[model samples]
Target: MLHRCNEQLQQFSHVNKKALDQYVNFTEQREELQKRQAELDAGDEKIKELISVLDQRKDESIERTFKGVARHFREVFSELVQGGHGHLVMMKKKDGEPADDDDEDGPREADMEGRVEKYIGVSFTGQGETQSMKQLSGGQKTVVALTLIFAIQRCDPAPFYLFDEIDAALDPQYRTAVGNMIRRLADTSNTQFITTTFRPELVKVADQIYGVTHKNRVSRVNVVSRDDALDFIEHDQSYNAE
Candidate 1:
């Protein structure tokens, strides 16, 4: 019996060494994994803060651009009009946004994406009222639309511009203002403007003028004197009748 017990004890000693080695290796690996996880957790907050700051900077950029355009629009509108002003109205999401497809709350950290939009609006005290596009008169709407285009271009100008009878709806005074505005813009920038108009005011501002007439059922472009251009505008009925 003593000999058998000694043999069993030797076998148990070898088995215990192998098991202990495996346990030690597992403990080391687990500790390393935990340390790595802690490191990642520490960096996570910084990454989220960076994202938030970048998002805020993006919003500020948009806001600055919007304000610039709006200011230019108001100035142009006033130049093209006698009274009232315009705005580039910004609309925002007033309610909390749903975070998930099921309408669950989204991650608070990722919520900085744009939840706002901007729209153009105007008011005409000359009309004795103030309202959106739906309530504005034809001339009012035309002036507003034109001023908006001019504002956007002023902020980010194109190489050139093409306008088709943009002053048709305005009165003589306003038409002349628009024509002067075009001339000033042309002088300020290298951008050229090709505009079509029946107003003598606009023709007077033009470097060259063309008279389009259907003679013998064919369209022809006639280079005319400033006086002749006035004749065509004032005598539209006779000009077209002939």
Candidate 2:
């Protein structure tokens, strides 16, 4: 009877072991399914974010293209009119109304007009400045010209800037201000600038200097070494004093 009881106990122990193994397998399958569902959810969220980014980029591209075209038009008109006034206008539909006015039906014209109005600003200088252009001392006119040119440049920055005699008429203080402003613009826009001037003070700030003079009716250009250029200027001043 003791031997029989021992055999039954062994059988019961084997059955419990098999049942525990099945329970562990079911638990593993449930955890794997949960993990896979989380991965799917994460992938869906990433796709949604990518779509949103792409849509934002598309809208930005469209807006920039419109602004660029408007800028080109303004430049052309200003050039043609010799810096005279020009206007850019845009039309938009009233809120809660159809996109078209009495003149047209489609959305294209309204959209175009809206973009034009949205991006362009009317720019003008005082008549006093223009009228005094000639009578104003060279220094004053230089300031005015630089102000206008800088204002236009600030409106739409580019990769390069060319300035010829911009500070020739400025005083020492104004010249320093102009230089500082140039450096600021360079820092902000990654712009490279080349300016030509007869002023020694201005040339001191230049990265490179080219000296041009007419000799015997022929134009001669020399890349001036900084020290040599300074010595030459001193020699010329001494001779003038003598």
Candidate 3:
């Protein structure tokens, strides 16, 4: 009789707990859903505000850099091209980078569009009418690229710079211009410039030459005097001619 009574009470307890389980779980589930909705609002004003401030600073920086670069570019390009003149114009290419997401700029296209997308357009007379990089001859493009590089370095100079055959496209004239430039900068400027090149012209202007040679598998660096390097190059060229 006692066993039957205990079994009946256990069954009664199971049904009562099942009935309360839904109400107990519903309270926590609703709170979590509410929290998730708040997080997923898709409107992050603080992030947007931070982005706007950064964009404004970027525009100002680019504007100042463009002015400095354009002025220097005109002078150097002229020198490099042997009486050539060019212009550097900053214009919009496309929004440099889009908003954090499409939704971030929703309904604010006009404001955000103007904030991004500034690029420099290079045009030179006598380089044909195309005024495009692709249409430019190798030497012409090298002059433009090297001029801009020097211009930027002038604007914001650091201790040293590295170059790897930056004037490989140039002919003798432009190469000499580049050599003269290297000489001038090395003699006048406090900053050191390091470059690797096969051009004898460049080696002549270089203050130091670290000749890298790979033997078997290991590379060795030979520090050669400028006078010796020039003599070696002349001898090699003469031998090649013979």
Steric collisions counted per model: 1, 0, 0
Query: Per-residue lDDT of 100-190 in model 1, one digit per residue for the tens?
Result: 2121122223245643232222233334343667776788788878888899889999988989988878877888888899999989988
TM-score of each: 0.62, 0.41, 0.64
94-162 per-residue lDDT for model 3 (tens digits):
743312211121122233544645443444434323276777788778787888888887778778878
Checking candidate 3 for backbone clashes, the offending pairs are none
Error of 3 at 77 (Å): 0.9
Q: Which stretches of candidate 1 lie over 4 Å from their true place?
A: 1-58, 95-113, 116-130, 215-218, 237-242
Clashing pairs for model 2 are none
The candidate scoring highest on TM-score is 3
lDDT of 2: 0.58
**Which is superior by lDDT, 1 or 2?**
1
Model 1, global lDDT: 0.72
**TM-score winner, 1 or 2:** 1
Please report how far candidate 2 places residue 182 from its true position, in Å.
2.0
Question: What's model 2's lDDT at 63?
Answer: 46
